[model samples]
Target: MNKNKALFTLTLVFALLFVWTVAEAGSSKRRGTAGAMELLIPIGSRNLAMGGSDIAGVSGVEAGYWNPAGLSQINNRVEALFSYQRWIGDINTVYAGVVAQLGRIGSLGFNLSSLDFGEINVTTTDAPDGTGETYTPQYLTLGVTYSKEMTDRINFGATIKLISESIMRQSASGLAFDAGVQYSMMDEKLRLGIAVRNVGTNMRFDGPDLEIKVQPPGTEPGAAQRPFRVPLQEFELPAQVELGLAHDVVASESIVWTVSGSFLHNNFSFDEYKLGTEFVLNEMFAVRGGYVLAQDPDEDTFYSLSEDFIFGPSFGFGLNYPLNATTHLKLDYAYRMTKFFDSHQLFTLSLGF
Candidate 1:
């Protein structure tokens, strides 16, 4: 699992705490909003050991966001997952996803994720500090997807999503989409995949704001018929493209080794390359690790604390329980260490029918 993004997500918070901790520094406190949607960190095997990625062969509701094409391999039943992430301190995130077969058509899935910002008191410079108002900043994501298998080695899928970010009295909302394709060979042991996600328009804020004073009673021309607009210019959405491949070596009926690699395209910035590998013992125990390197343009990041340093490495283990030949239960755990911050932990529960 990788929490590299945590550094980026909490970047502003560190500044917030600095304002409260460092006295003189607090005098010139920085008040601002962070740009960019944090990346979706990953922590699971069956893919991680290969190279920290799998674009062409995802097979669960979580894959709906990772790679929809994996949906082609659904077993005509229902599968679901719940994951908890301990990102640094005071920041906890939860994710839930489900996939179900749709008759002879294909497979459909849903996903939801929530991010909690804890609680903070709201204040303004003029109120001389506290207006006694407080609020929490929370973010949410919801998506639905459909996938179809066209051939033994080919699959296609797509998803639509709703995103919301809310703070004390203010909020922003938007929509996005993801699409994927996957192919497999070597008796379903070798695979490849590709996906494009978060490709959509920007979001705009809609809430009470600092109002302006104006004269009434038709004193102005269109003031009575039209409203003044702040038009918080819609900004660019976080868009990404990913390609990955994986291969599994069946050491025996009970043992297997898998390796995977992924090429990522970060639209708003430089690209990234990630690789991972895992070993499974007796289909019950697994161990995995991965490394990620960012392609920096400024190259100054050769030593920067920006989330751009996803360059750190990650590792973890997992346990799987077979309910039957076509179904089972799995628990996966992962950890990631950044070059300049607290490590992250990821735990996921999966149930397959």
Candidate 2:
């Protein structure tokens, strides 16, 4: 059948991409060079609870951030979600999204993610102690996504996001794109997903903060101060590609279990491997856990735990309640173990109608 051919083509493409990602995973020279690091942070609580391994199984409005191809799984007419995270360093992230079905054509999604850095005392070369002034930094991203089921076994989607960051007066803005594909086989028992994220143009900060009023050297004492603008170096976006696989190990009326694994190839950092598991009881409650290996698992030990910044293990749970035949409420929470400071927690509320 024609649909079978399409599925085969998509599968081949995804496999090639996965191979390429693994081939380049050895490059560790680009660390910290890329800007827009916020793009690398995982967004959805459900997705995070699954240890960022939901590319093959994510659905609904939350898929706007994880893997848009899964948006096609939204069977309801409309869906909405709100999430909050008390991230590292007392930073807070707020997220919201809405998705709507478009007849038989496809699904459309809109989502916003904002990082609140709170207020910090202003410091300068002259005033290292304190300037008695405070300012907040903002990192925001607004995205629009479209997804469609190409066939019974294949789905495709894309997202275009506007990214903006501002600190006091200096600000920089840029655009990025995300594309993904999902394939299911063997009566939906097996799933594969591939996505390329944060592909965009270079960006640099420019504003009044970079402008300085200073006197030219060797000038007369009464010489007027000239305005000098410090040029900021442009940086590339933190682009990466992800490959994920998930399988329904067991499916029944009262209990279900799914296992997933993912490979992340970061252009700005070391590659990572993640394994996650989820157990659902009566289709109303779920528990999850995962382990992440940063580059080499053998090197990950208590001796080097303090030197490394990335976390390793995580655990979480979720609860779902049905309001009606066409509506339901879902709540999810996750806790991530870290090497330094404190662990991270996330909470999310989702509604379907």
Backbone clashes, each candidate: 14, 0
Question: Global CA lDDT of candidate 1, please?
Answer: 0.68
Candidate 1, superposed: residue stretches over 4 Å from native: 1-51, 127-129, 214-230, 298-311, 323-327
Compose the digit string of candidate 2's lDDT tens values, residues 1-353: 89988877876776676675556443446567889988877777766877788688878887877788988788689989999988888888899999899977899999999999888999989999879999999999999999999988889989999999999899999999887888887899899888888878899999997899999999999899999999999988887788899999998899989999998777777667778889999979999988777663234433222355457677899898999999989999988877665788989999989
Most TM-score-accurate candidate: 2
State the weakest 10-residue window (summed lDDT) of model 1. 24-33
Question: How good is model 2 by TM-score?
Answer: 0.92
Q: Write the per-residue lDDT of candidate 1 for residues 210-280, one digit (tens) a residue.
A: 24445466576656443454556555566667778888866578888877888776555555687787778
Number of clashing residue pairs, candidate 1: 14
Residue 198 lDDT in candidate 2: 82
